[model samples]
Target: MKRKIRVLVAKPGLDGHDRGAKVVARSLRDAGFEVIYTGIRQTPAMIAEAALQEDVDVVGLSVLSGAHMALVPKVKEALVAQGMDDVLVLVGGIIPNEDVPALNAIGVKGIFGPGTATQEIVDFIHKELAEPAA
Candidate 1:
């Protein structure tokens, strides 16, 4: 059997809402990915540490507070500092198109906005993080 793709889903900063994060975590789990959800009130450092401890293949940040610009890079930087830079990073939530470039420049491989089908997120993770099928 192929190794299951492992994902760490995090809510960075002070975002009190986690319905979307929980939904996505369930979707990824249903799609055969092992998901670790860190829940709300997480700092970038906390997220990175969880990613390291979980040995995840991807880190998915669910941010709805519009602080992606500030928090996302910090998570990436922390990942780099912890030598977890090889892990793929992704973001999902109310991200604006204007901020997409900046997020990409910081190594976020995929960004899913609101109303994006869970299947789309699942497919993207499979395409980007899953190992090639034998």
Candidate 2:
């Protein structure tokens, strides 16, 4: 049997705004996936630790402190340091288009911004994980 995808949705840095993260977590849950939400104000190391402990298939970070550049790379580095490079890293919330390429270059596969439909995020993850590995 194919196991359900486990996702860790986190709010990193000093961002207190959590409505978006909560909404997406609910949406993903409704879609029948397992979601672990880490609440708010998480550091990169804390998030990485949670992801490893939960053994999640994906880590979705919500950053609105304009620190996406600094935060995302740190999280990615922690994941790699923990030997969890296989986990897919995703980001969302007020990210500038210019930062998108850099985020991808640092190992984040999905970068959702404001106005991005939850369905799109859900669908993308589904399609991405469904592809056969070469």
Which candidate should be chosen as best, given lDDT against the real structure?
2
lDDT of 1 at 127: 82
TM-score (C-alpha) between model 1 and the true structure: 0.95
Poorest stretch of ten by lDDT in candidate 2 = 125-134
Q: Write the per-residue lDDT of candidate 1 for residues 1-134, one digit (tens) a residue.
A: 86878999999999799999999999999998899988999999999999999999999999999998999999999999999989999999999999999899989999999999999998887788655789
Worst 10 residues of 1 by lDDT: 124-133
Clash count of each predicted structure: 0, 0
Task: Kindly provide the TM-score of model 2 when superposed on the true structure, using C-alpha atoms.
Answer: 0.96
Clashes of 1: 0
How much is the lDDT of residue 134 in candidate 1? Answer: 90
Give TM-scores for every candidate, taking all chains together and pairing residue i with residue i. 0.95, 0.96
